[model samples]
Structure formats: structure tokens, C-alpha cells
Target chain A: MPALANLTSREELLAEALGEGWRPGPPPGGEAEDAPPDLLPKALPLSQVIRVDYVVPGCPPPAPLIGEFFNAFLSGEMPEPGYVFAKVKALCEECPRTREERVLKKIVRPHELLPAPEVCLLDQGMICLGPVTCGGCSAACPSAGMPCTGCLGPTPKAGDMGLAMISALASLVRAGEEGEETIPKEDEILDALVDPIGTLYKFGVPTSLSPLRERAGVRGSSSPYPVPYQRGRGGEEGGGR
Target chain B: MKKIVIDPITRLEGHGKILLYLDEAGGLKDAVLEIPELRGFERFCQGRRAEEMPQITERICGVCPEAHHLASAKALDECYSAEVPEPARLQRELFYDAYIFSDHLLHLVFLGGPDLLLPQDTPKGQRNVLGVLQAHPELGKQVVKVRARAQRILDLIGGKAIHPVFALPGGVAQPLSQEAREEIRGHAQAMVGLAERMVTFFHEQVLPDPGIQSLLLAEECRLPTHYMGLVDEEGAPNFYHGALRIVSAAGEEIYCGDAREALSLIEEHTEPWTYVKFPYLKEFSWQGFSAGVESGIYRVGPLARINVAERMATPLAQEEFERFFDHFGERPVHATFAYHWARLIEMVQAAEDVARLSEEDALTGREVRGELSSPGEGIGVIEAARGTLFHHYKLSPEGLVEFVNLIVATTHNAAGIGLSVKQMAARVVKEGELDERLLNRVEMAFRAYDPCLACATHFLPGETPLAVEIYDAQGVLKQRIVR
Candidate 1:
């Protein structure tokens, strides 16, 4: 597991937050061997021969949380399930990022990382998977956080690849790029949001506008992209550049 | 000869077709096995952020999500030049073990059991596991209990019984608790006992009987063929990770080295006749099939892994491993029928290893992983139930993925399987009765690869071939298409 910590689990969060009251308690301490905190926490079984144990996190939660949860539970006081364990929480309620529309004529880069609380990026005329993304990490990116990059996979209601929601978000961004307060025309929005490569063309105005190619629309292939793109500034070759 | 056709063999994952062409003179002309489905899984991954692949690729196959997750993670690791730290490595090992354990359990008691215990010609109503229960109630109960236990483990680790999403690019997304660890330990022991009983069943009551064995043995399902698999640090069949090797039918090392080199040496070619692509050494394209240790095309999977590995890591498996080799000698067994024996031995080894790993102190720990500070690539390979699976990828500096190529277990044996089918067809089919039972037997030989047609053919199911035509010099069709 990576050094990243997960505050996703109810037991792990309860032990770490054990009365810490809102200060985001020390990144939910536990062993490092647990799960990396970046995505949904899930337990990794000891082996096929043994029956698996369900940890509060996804497959396996952060190691520290696992240890802490173990200690806390072993200590006799059962760690209460966190918000997600409540059985009635919607994904939006769990996410820190809100959604609303605010038209913008230009693109925002990583340098302009400043975030406004309460107002959503889509509403502000920006592209984001935050609202539509699952918030097991308490909207980790937007909350403490960098922008939400959807580590929790997709939100439960979002459907596979969350095509419709992504399309809506991209169209909203395109409308803002066109300097129009509202998307008065569907064809113009579609044209504005297409990717240069037909590959992910289905994913982008319908997806978003990378600053490098504003005219590039999202292609709708099963593939993530036509050409692999490295993420951020790392030299690593990524499917999405 | 009577015509027999088992149109679609039940209990295997994915879709495939088999055809047997016989000449008017009662000689078999060709036996073709075709896979006809494409999911566009890897192709759809292009342009998407690399980080999304772990989950995205999980959708590739519901039957073996762990295989893709492990392979995808390795591919991403390669993209970044990143090596997973020690703790992360241990954690990943444990994580993968959970998946393998669950999957094997699924295959054996669930998918493969019915065929082993029930009569092949038994009425459809009594051919399934449920039917077995009515005949052998105690064994059925044991199988159900084992399945339930395995499912429990899967639910805890992957959040579901089918597709598990526990693995991530750098490491795992979750960890284990002490209570969970102890439960797993208990289960592991019980499973070992069950496996012992199964071995007895195979030896005492199964293998020596009438039915599939006589025809299988007479038909010579044990011929020598080439084999390939991964070699661990200890030079054994390390199922989780290792190096690649290609061994001749006589058990001599042919090609041994890193996976990337293997990739460069092997070429993939598409044939419009089948959905699966053909893979072979660029140098050995025309060797064709032969009766003996011909440098002809061959196969992979369990028998191959057992042959290439110096020895077994577990005690019981090592004992059984010796007996396995003693029967076959140095030559590679080309007979597709031997795959079951090899699979059983590997299963025994995997079970024993699970028992040992379960008791290790490292199995229960708090510091399961370390911090990732570097941006690099990480490659992971494993000897999946089918064959050698390779996962290579490049991750961006910020921890997102860039490029990926998951050469699955089935893909490695694609060309070889096609060749095996053709060879078996040529030897069988004496009278042009178009024997369905013989055809099914030949098909099973290829299915031993458990080829994932989607992964092998770049995720596209080949369209149903209308016919394969061969013409004489006079322009008359030499062979007409027949059902």
C-alpha cells in the first residue's frame, strides 16, 4: 500500500477521529501495509485457503486504520460505523465538492488551483468529475484537497463510465467557453466539446476542454483515449495527457 | 462412425466454437476451434487517465477481475519506472493470494467439479453440481461449505463475490485486521483437509475407471509438446510473479529471460478465420505439427509451468511433482489431456502455500506498506490459472497512468492452441461421421488454455467465419463447408 491515508472507513475514521472533532484527525493512523488511502478501501485476504475479513475500507483500508481499528475493537468499544455506514447517505452528501453553473470564457490550469467553497465547478463553468464521483474519501481532493480526480471509482448512481453525467458537465463547460450564459443550441455545444481524436470524443463536451485543444471533442470509444497521455508533468506516458 | 456434436460445452468462461471438416474418403481435413467475441476493453482505455484503469479494466471479465487488476497495476508500474516498496510488495502478495485462493476455489468445486464427478452423458438434469449433491450428498455438502467460505473472503476483500477492486497502481486500497487474519487461518487449514480427500477421490475412484480415460488414452492425449511459464527466484512456478521461459517438449530450456524480450521475439498475427490472433516465435512460423519432439508449434499453462520450474516450493506438491515428471520424462507432453493432472498438482501446491503463508507472522502486521516518493514504472507478472500473464504500464509523475499492455494468460497460448486443434483433428476423425464427442474432446484440449478471446484478440470478438475454402488447380472447391 502507498503512504496515502484513507479516512473512508467508518471504524478507521471513528478511531482516528475518536473525539478529535473536525480537525481531520492525523490522517487515520494505522499500519502502512493496509490499503493506500487514495481510493476506496477494500480488504486483501490472507489467502484463498482462509476466509476473508471485511475491513471498513474498500478491499483493504490504510494499514494504520486497520491496526487502529483492530486495537479500538479489541479494546472492547466497537468502533461505530462512519457516515457511509449509516445506510442512508447519498454520494453527493458525502462529497465535499458542490455543483452549480458559472460561465467562463477561458480554461483554468493547475496554477489557478484556488477553490471556492459551496459553489460547484460545473456551475462555475469548469470541468470536474467531483459531484458525479463517489465520496468515500470524504471528497479528499476537494475537501483538503486537490481537485477531485475520482479515486473512488464512479459514484454508485453514475452508471458505468458515467457517460451521461460527463456529457452534461462538458456541455456546461463548452457553453461557458462560447461566452454563452446558457447552452441555447445542442449542435453548437456538441461541436465545441469534441476531441481531435474520435477515440474519447464521446467522453469530453460530453467531456471537457483541455487547454491544448479547445476544439478537441471527447471521442466515444471504449478506449480511454486515442493516444496515451502522460498525467501532469511526469514523463510517464498516460492514457490521458 | 456416428456423428456427435456437443455444440456448446458448458461450464467454461467466455464463448467459442468448434468445427470438424472431413473428406469424402473418411479422413479428417481440419478441426477448427474459434472464439468469437470482442469487448473492446483495452482499446477503450486509450486517452483515459491511467489511474482509472485499475477499476476500468476490472470490467473486462467478471470471472477473473483479479487477473486484470494485477496485470494493469504491473503495466502502470512499468510506465513510471516505480518499484513497489517491500511492505507494498508483501501487501500486494497477500492481496493477490486472496484473489487466487478465491478464484481457484471457484474453478475447482464450482466449474470443474461437475465434469470430474458426474457422467458426461448423464441427463442434463443430473450433470450439474446440484445433481452431484443428490448422488454424493456428503461431497456436495463439503463443496458448498467450501464455496461459502471462499465467498465470505471475497466479500470482505473485494466488496463483492465476483469482481474485486482491492488492488491499486502503487499498492492496495485496503488492509487486513487480526480477527480477519485468524479466520482466514482457520479456513486455510480446513481447505487443506478437503483437498486431501479430493486427491484420494481422484486416485482411488476417478482416474482408473472406464469412460473418458480409455478413449482419451487410446487417442493419445499425452503427446509431447513445448511448454512455457514463469520462473521464480527459487526457479519454481511462483504463481504471483516471476520471469518467463520457453521449454522444449524434452524439458530443455529454449528461451529464458525477461518478459519485454519475450514480447519482442514473439509476434501476433490476425487470421480472419478465427477471432483469436495467432502468436508464435517470428522464427518458427512454418515448423507445423509433428509426431515426436519436432521443433513444431506447442502450448502452455500448468503442465508447461510444472515442466519449466526446477521444483515445487511446497512439500506435498514437490512429492506429487516428482511423480508427475517421472511419468512424462524429459519430453514435453503434447497430449492436451495431461493438463488436468498438471492443474491438480498446481492446485495442491497453491493450497499448501496458502496454508503456510496464512501462518506467517508477516501475514498479520500494521506496517503493511510504505510511502511512494518516486515516479516510475512497475511491472508485475503471474502464472494465472491459464498461463503466464504480463501487466506493463507507465504512470505519470503525479501518480496517474499513461500507457498499458496486458498480455493475458490466454493470449500467450493463442497460436499454439490453434495448432494443437489442427494436429488433434488430423490424427482423429477416421470415418467422416463428424463425431461431436471427439470434436468436444479436441476442443477441450484448446480450452486448457482457458483462452480469454477478448484479451487475446485485442478485445474484439471475431465475426463468425462463413467458411474456410481450399481450391484445386482446376478452380473447383476441394472441400465444401459442412456442419
Candidate 2:
């Protein structure tokens, strides 16, 4: 079996299904005028493949976890079927640092400031996805003084990791004494996020609910943001979740 | 004419297939290793921040993520024209050495070792890591322990054993802590001991075995091609930093200079059947891939590195290197199986390098990062565990990546691998009697190169179920084997 057998995108699954004579048509309403035709019959994750016995999560699963999995198999003590994931559901639960809800005056990139060793990176005004990302890596990035970028995909219950991260960030950004008026503008928040899709969906875009477009609805229609994420534009349109 | 397809070649990285064309008499005519996967990585890279390259590119291959990470990071350094600080350079070298030790150990013990250790006629079910473990538990323990120690060293410096987040544009993202340094030193010491044991085991157990020794020097496995690797100013084997060195088939140093010149000296040839483009020296003017000293094809990796280098950097590995030359009786050893021996010697050198670098005071210094400037075009070259890897990038002034051209180690050896498969298939298959053992022998020829097609072909996630089909002269399916 191939190493990445259970980690394919929805489109890849549809292509394979189509090769096996699973014909697919466009979505309802003849599809959006600007959107590509919906070749995917359904948003079926690769994990749902009948032949898939187990899944070892992580952008690249750590060596020790793999060693343990093999050792278990060799010892004839098989893990339960389905997702053989890390014990820690979310990166925040595995992080060694402290976390407390607080307002931020401004967001900062990782290189801008040297973070305190034992403070929550998100609390330090850095855009870290520890709270929304699936853990079991022992908070490797945060422990090394870098912020977690959700490479391990999403928590088990989170429908979309990127959307969860956006909601988390929105709630964390506190308004000044002037109340909601002092809060950072949506554009300002998007600018601070910089490549929000790339950051939040770094490794899980294919598995995320909003693999192509965000749930906020079609862009340039009624949304304040007129354009979608375009490659090589350096986020000039400020389009993100 | 007849065609036999070995689809989804296994026991190696990524997806690939081998096509063997034969005459009506079942005599082999030609063999081609086809890499049918392409993920459009160059397109994906466009519009990404130059700084995110190190992180994004590393995801290309799970087996050699560190190589991609460091190569991408070095490219960023050159793009900004940033001078890496002393401590940062030392840290990068240390991290790279650890990766070399761990990756080489994996190939030697698990991937390639089983073929050399077990009998050639070993049952198909017993020709894998599990079989080796069942046969020799003590050796299995050593393999696990050494790999774990190497992983610890990588985690200590790189932040994670896989997809590490330490490298930055000018330097490493984090400085080494005193405690981490001490831990790494301890692991490095243990690693050196393990490497020495592995070398001794190879000499005593494998070298003396008449069957294995004969197979190592088998004429069917030999391909007299040129060699390419990175060597220091003194012509010593240097994995982290060095100039590109190319040696002709006759062991003459034909080209030695910076990476840019080397890049210009080579051109790529694309075949419609495969996504991988065959790269050959331009001086020969695209004669196409063939067997012989004048094939214009060059191999990279352990055997090529040792063949091209003047000497190993460390004393122990250098001593072993002399013994290797005595056995081969030549400067450029063309025997394909010599790759395993060269890989073992390199593992020893990497272990020694880590021990030496860990004691430096600068390794623990706080000055890890340097300033970055506006982006431009740059090329970064480094000797990955497999061979010399190149990452070329063009970035906009605002630091967004405009273009990317990556020549991974496996891509350099694709032509050589195709030749090897052809040679082995001709020798093993007769009268169209393609059994499990005969088919495995063909796979062994490709596996010896340790080609990571995932990195070479830019493949994406999917199932790779191998299917072998033999077609008769009239294009009628005669036999099919599906796994």
C-alpha cells in the first residue's frame, strides 16, 4: 500500500471514484457562474475508504508514534480500528505554557518579538493555532519558541480548523473602553492574519469543510471582501476566512 | 513485441512503474522507469512568501523533510543576500549531520540491509524488515535504539523529528539552549558507538559471505557512468557546505566549481510517459540515456559521493574509505551495490561530525539570526542523505516567491535507475517466466539507489496498488498479477 493512501483530497477521491464509473454532475442551480463545475459527487474524506484500516495523523507523524504503532502490531496488540490518532485532542491541551483569555492591542508576527518561554503564544499577540490544532506532538513548535500552525490537522469535533481559528481569534480580540467601536476592523484583522488559509489550512485544507470557499458565502457577491485568495498576489485583496 | 508493466513499484518512496519491452522470443529490448505522478509543486509555490518556503517545501517528502527544509532556507538566505552568522551556520550543520546519520541508518538497516543480509533466494514473505527482526532480534534492537537516538538529536535542535520548524531566512529560528546542547552531546556520543558497530557488522557478516560478495561485484549491476557530489576546498566529503564536483567515468575531475556553473552544465529531457525529466550533461549534447562510459548520464548518492571525494573528513571513515578503494581497485567504483558500503561509511562520518560540532562554544551562543534584505534570485545547493540537492528560487522585491526549480537527489539518478532495471530484467527474466523471485530481483536493482520518487516526481496523496501485466506480440493480455 502507498504511504499516503488515507490522506487524499476530496477531488482525488472523486477522480478515483469516477475512474471506477461513478459519474458526477454539477452542484444544484447549475453551479456558480464564476465557480468551477463541481466534479466531486460528495465530500468524502479518504479516511472513509472501505480499505482504510487506520490513520496516523500529523503533517508528518513523529518517529516515536510510528515506532509505537509498529511495535504494537509486531506484538499482536492491534489498536482499535478507525483513526489511531494522538492522545491529546487539541494542541492547547498538550502545551506546557499557561493560557488565559485576554484582549490584544495589536497582532505581531513571530519574528517581530522574542516570546516569553512559558506564555501562551496566542496570548502574546502571535497568531498561533495551538487551541484549534490536534496535538500529540508535545507542543513541539511552541516549546521550541515557535508558534503552532496547525500542521496536525483539526481537533476531532471541529468541522473546519480554519473557521475555528477565525472564531477563536475574533473572540480573543478585545474592544477598548469605547466598546465594539475600538475593536480592530475586519480588514485589519485579516491583514494581521496574513495568508490566513495558508496558515489555518496548512496541512488540512483537503480534509477541511471549506476546502475551496469559506462558509461566509461567495466572494465579490455580498461579502465586504471583493476578491478570493489569489496566488502570487501577496494577499493584496485581503481575502481570507 | 511484448510489454510487461510493474506498476506502482514498491519498497521505496512515492509512486512509479517499470515498463519492460521484449521481442517475441521474450528477449528484453528496453526498460523504462516511469514516474507518472506530478503535484504541480512549482505552481503551488508561486505567491507564497519567500520565508514560508522552508516550511512548505519540507512537506514534499516525509522521508527527507529536513533536506528540503534546509535547502529551502539556504535559498532564502541567498535571495536576501544575508550573511549567516557563525553560530547559525554551526547550528545548521549540526542539525544536518544528525539528519544524515538517522536517514542513512534507516536505509542501511531496514530498506537495503535486508537484501544484503538475507539469502538471495529467501522467501518473498521473509524479505523485509519484519523478517530481519525475526531472524536477529539483537541487531533489530540496535537498529531501533540508534534510530531513536538520532531522532532525539534532531528533535533537540530542529524542534521536531519530522517537519521541523527551526530554519529561518538568515539563520535558525531558535538558539540552542545549554541543556539541549548537553543532551545532544550525549546522543552524539552514543550515535558514534552505534555507527562503529554497524560498520564492523557489515565487514564481518556481509563482506566474508561468498554469495553476497559475488553479488556486490556482479557485472549485471555495474554501470560505468560519471559521478557528481559536493566536496570541500580540500576535496573532502562535505554534506552541509561545499562546491559541486563532477568526475568523469574514467575518474578524471572534469568539472569543479560553484553550483550555478554546474546547473548551466546540465539540461533536462522530458519523456511523455513519465513526469520525471532525465537530466544529462550538456557537453555531451543530449545523446539520450544508454549504458557505457560515454552514456552522458551521472549518478549521485553515497557511492557517487565517495567516488568523487578526495577522502572522508573523519579519521575512522577515511580509514574505511581506503579499504573500500583497495577492494574496488579504482577511484570511481561503478558497482551499484557499493552504495550500501559507502552509505555505512558516511553514517560513521556523520556521527563523528555531530560529536565534534556539539563541543563548540558557538553552538550554544544566542546569536542565531541575521538581518534580511529585499528578495532576488538565488540558488542553494547541499548534499542531502541521498545525494546533492539543489533549490533555485526567484522572489519578488516584496518577498513573494515568483518561481521555483528544485532538482532533488532522486531526479539525478532516474536515468541510472532505468538502466539498472533493464540490466537486471535481462539477466533475471527468461522465456517470459516472471515469478515472484525474478520480479523481486528487478525491484532490488531500483531499491539499491534508494530513489525517493515522492520528492523527485512531486507526487500527491493516493493509493499505489501495484499491478503487473504481460502483453503478447499482438497486444493480447497474457498474464496479470495484482497486489
DockQ of each: 0.03, 0.13
Candidate 2 clash pair list: A232-B47
Best-performing candidate as measured by lDDT: 2
Ten contiguous residues with the weakest lDDT in model 1 chain A: A22-31
True lDDT of residue A131, candidate 2: 77
lDDT by residue (A101-210, candidate 1, tens digit) is 44433433211223455565444433445555433444433432233444333333443334635454554444333545555653444443222232122222222223
Question: What is the DockQ score, from 0 to 1, of model 1?
Answer: 0.03
Where does candidate 1 chain B have its weakest 10-residue lDDT segment? Answer: B1-10
The runs of at least 3 residues in candidate 1 whose Cα sits more than 4 Å from the true structure, single-residue gaps closed, are: A1-241, B1-9, B123-125, B159-161, B286-296, B327-331, B364-379, B394-403, B423-428, B431-439, B458-483
Model 1 CA lDDT for position B262: 74
